[model samples]
Target: MFHSVCQVPTAKVCGDGKPSRRGRSFIYRLKDEDQVPQQVCKLFFLSTLGYHPTNDSLVLSVMGKDISTPLAPPKDQRGRHAPANKLDQKPLHEHIESFHPSVSHYRREHAPWRRYLPSDISMKLMYADYIEKDNKCSYESYRKAVKSLNISFTQLGEEQCESCLLQEQHVKADHQGEAAVNCPQCEKWQIHKDSATGSRLHYQSDAERDLPEDTSTRSVDLQKVIMLSRMPGVKSAVFTRRIVAYHETFVSVGKKTNKKNTISVVWHEGIAGRSAAEITSAYAAALEKERDIKHIVYWVDNCSSQNKNWCLFSSLVSIVNSQTISTEDITLKFFHPGHTFMSADSFHHGVEQEMKSRPGGVVFGCSRIV
Candidate 1:
């Protein structure tokens, strides 16, 4: 017989619609699978605070009038064979019906403040458990845990872009021990990204061109369509400061044709031209060192960034699908309005919001779908 304050409280509803039968004679036993026989028929009387949601725990209670029965452990240590009057607990799989919880129906939180969901937190917990099991509680272990947990490091949450699982790995590898380098504005412990503006593509122009054009066709992957939106608000025209902004685009290419892909592009009105070819050309031109000139098909929304097609298919980006160009190329498409690009394009939202946010009290909200 056991009762403790940490156990689930049993409140009997009286005729007057009030809780009654308050008592203190309670006991508790550790929730041990092997100790079931010794713990049954245990009387646990939880004291005050039992009815509160935050105080609930898994604890079995027995009453004075309840009858008792002998029990025996199961041969497999998974179920009790002698509790014939009541079936003992079944295996966890028995309760789960074909459950593969991760990556399915994921709780996608696009909030700039919160990028993770409950399952992601649980996965990190499990990953921590994994670390403890392997006796590898190193910084690298924690970094991997952040990835498996699918969340940013608690401290680096402010650096939303670098907090990505992949980017964390990169930073860890390329930390280079924070040498003292003269920055334009200021210097800090780590090699500040803004100061360094590290080489995105390493150039090997000195090397001979060994690869052929036909063989240069690399695998292009198409990813999920990404959506970008911001919280609505009003503004005034009495500000003295000028406004500045940055625009960006995210491209998701299919691993190969016949597969689906996604691209999330959020750009300013003037910075990223309102043309499909120009936007992609900007990307290709910027990534020339790492990317080869290739034909690209972009299927985006009927927004101004893309020209509106006045045919059976009205979407400007849809014209790519109806094109007659014959070449081994990559195809990118926008995810549905609300979906976000996957692991590939991490900071698409932040880039979009930074650009479209109110500038110099002039409304720059691209609310019009056209």
Candidate 2:
């Protein structure tokens, strides 16, 4: 029997090429110019490089205009101008990518572990040099060195401890043998509080005592926080005290400064922390004088009397005006809690160490002042 034969097409025109032609054939438009070719190859455009189109040699066709230029934004005459930068909010993303080092060569260390002491830098360098990347043995060596140096946990190098003997000597010599009043908690019996008669009363407790007694020792310490309140260009300090006796201490502390002229007001051993008018009068007198003292920072702790006693505040105000000081020039501020012992000041530290020498001083004195 004779059968009709049909020809099979070639593989190149299958059409799964650029832009997904999917086997489409084109008819010449309107047979315009009747001279058109009978068969036409399709043109495809692909964006990604280094990839093949299904049929490698696709024909090129002319396409339309520019695509990159962005359209202008819509006008919003009624809308307000762009909000300020401070008003912008951060964008939110679903997830984050992060990388961790395969080896932890730089381990965390506690700063101020031993009070910033001055000590050998050799062990630090030695451990740093030997620590190998991703090597357990190197880490073990570092641990061993840390234990050997006894400085592994404490970042202190044994040189910067403010309570060191060398530091104390330097402070005393610098102050011309006049020492600071150490924090009462650390200074032991040397911490003195004046009774109503203005006499010295020492309180004692070893400032060196610390927690975990058997394994480590906490050296006793003291910190003095200086407070000041200033207005505009002028500054004045207000000494702080918990009780009335603090006024006496404040006056005494002032006496410790280099005094070229004598203070007009006399010290009243019998009556202290009272007589607001008298205190104001004294401040006014100081303001009237033209001393070399420029800006003053008077540190004062929280006292109800400061607000309760109208006379004292009034006195301060008058003094500010008389000293050519503006009311807003002075500012008053407090110190952080429990940091008084760490202060580098002389009185705060001295008071702590001296109490170590005095016996039975803590029996009658308080342990919070420095």
Candidate 3:
């Protein structure tokens, strides 16, 4: 069988004696006026010399007119050049090829990563890189570089960082001090309430004999500690009554800044009765000697069985109305369940920690722990 074959163009030597038959054949095949135009070769050489096709030449080339003398864009009936239809124009990549060198770097560098990567994925990767970039790089430097290079970059806020979100999700306890710092009530109490209490305390100390005994307002927190019940081997329940009194004395205050001063701690064993009456009686007995105390603000958690019941309310009212007691007005403030950590919780935590540090990690009796 005989095989038919087509002839391939033989390599030709240019003026520099470099052989390139492929380029020559392609140029010749264009067949300008049955021969390749001299300007075609000139333009090719110019392109090789890094001369880019100007906008004017590109417009003419796109319109299928010769680049040497590009025809003016046709005008409409209104005598203005008709705007090119973007839908009919070449693709962005083609336009990039025609763009001048001045802006070529911009177009080449900024091709969006979203074109290849999914938008969400690209954004996350960019944000991660932005954060973990040079440790010493300034914000302005990175931003300017991003702009110049056309990076697919996203800037996330401090809280929006992946590490920050992970940390927040894992956080177990609330920072009470930081929380208190932002509270307006806590701020005012620190500056005003504590200052007033200090003044009253000073006045009482300086002129206790001269001034007649009257009444004053006191703030207190009450909590029940049951370590006495959880004795080493025995499991009999004994409640350890913990009362934290806030006064204007120079004593070391607990962790809770709102509970400004630490006065005295009174503990009533379970033997004394764990009823509402017993609790109120303990509070009354502690303040009864302070005949000057007229109003009292008690901060406690809203445990209906213990503090918020009608029994406790009635007992407070009876004290104010009682002729024997000097207290006139009584206020009960209930804090949020888990967040009621100001004085009562602080005292409870301290007692529990101290008890846990013992040899057996348990408290047998109040006397042993105290």
Candidate 4:
């Protein structure tokens, strides 16, 4: 069978009566004894030997080696020939770490470890600043390094100070330095920052202050409206209108015991609107649970339609003068505008994380959100 498929042609004799070695070549027959094509026969023969006919390089490499020698182990070429322009990881990491000094931590007790940069700062701007200092890295590399640090650009639902934002815009618009130097907006921005800092300090002090047995401090905030029937990564969900749910959270810290209590009131739009009346009612219900406390210090944001309205004030007044409750004095303190970071906000963040972590990343109804 072998002689029928392959034949070594007779070599021409050289002048010295020796057969020429180069002319003795094997001539393959296109058809075997069964009239099968040589190509199909070659494929079947390779399969029997556990080799793929399509892998020409591997087949040729194996054929070129001596039968007595074993195949050498494969070599991993990764990272062996790096580009000359590859950046040194040390300086790139250092540049990214330098931004940590400007990063701010969340004031919420539950999420105190969460850090964020200013809203105006972004990876593009950070990369620009880095390159200005003669850093040798691409913008993509800088952005990846920054993301690996687990820092966010801003907290969810964070509001920037209007005065500071306006001042920055004014400074950028001004061509000459004289206008920005004596700008009233700049002065107002300074005052606004100072007030915000002071109010934040006061809130912390009150939250941590040791008080009498009957006194307590609490912070309240309404979370951003959550849309139900949430199906993350579903293209169809984008255009569809979803049910809106409201969540109002109150985080109370006891003065003597330092124990923290969290209360969440959730409702859909079909049940009640997020008007001042509904907010007041929900807060009043939370207050009813803490009737044993005589003096309550309430910290809240300055939303006119909710916490700062006359309806909520009236409700609080009625609670203070109630015959059954032990609440005599209720001091309502408002955080500085655009700087209202409260413990209640942390509860909302937790709820958001929970919703995202659901199986299939889908929430079918409002009840599932609760």
RMSD of each: 26.2, 24.9, 25.3, 15.2
Tens digits of lDDT, candidate 3, 1-370: 0011112344666667887644212121123566653334434543544557332344224333332333355556773665664232233223222221122111222332321222244433443454564333344444444444443322111111233233333332344333256655445444543543454344234323332233232334444444333345443323343333221111222222322233443454534655666666655665555435665555554557567777778876776787877776776655433223233334444555566676344332222111
| Residue pairs with backbone atoms closer than 3 Å in model 4 (clashes) | none
lDDT of 4 by residue, 1-370 (tens): 2332332445588789987765433333345689775633555555555668554354435333343344465578888988988777787778767776332434433445556776677888788888998777877888777777666675555565676567667777873433344667777777887898899889878877787778778788888898877777787886788889888777764354765466667788999999999999888877777788888888998899988898999888888898868988999899888788776666677777777778344332222122
Better of 2 and 3 by TM-score: 3
Per-residue error for 23 in candidate 2, Å, reads: 93
TM-score, predicted candidate 3 vs. hidden true structure: 0.31
| Clashing pairs counted in every model | 22, 47, 6, 0
| Candidate 1, 1-370: lDDT as tens digits | 2332222335577688997785323334434567553332232222332444333243323333222432223247656455645422232222211223222111233434323433234534544554455543444544453454344322112122222343345445655423334632223323343322221111111112243332222211112222222223423333323232333333322333322222233344345443456444433432332233245444333233432333312332333343432334444433232222232333343333444564323232223111
Question: Model 3: residues >4 Å from true position, as ranges?
Answer: 1-270, 357-370
lDDT of 2 by residue, 1-370 (tens): 0011111223444465635333322222211267543322222222122325443232112211122323244457864767554221111000000111111111111233222212243444444443432322344445453444334321211222223344356556765554556634234312221120121111111112222211111111112221122122332322432222222122112212221222223233334433455455544444444233444333333343432367766666655566464333322322222122211133333433444455323111222222
Score every model by TM-score. Answer: 0.23, 0.22, 0.31, 0.58
The prediction achieving the highest lDDT against the true structure is 4
Which lDDT values do the candidates have, in the order given?
0.33, 0.30, 0.41, 0.70
- lDDT, candidate 2, residue 84? 52
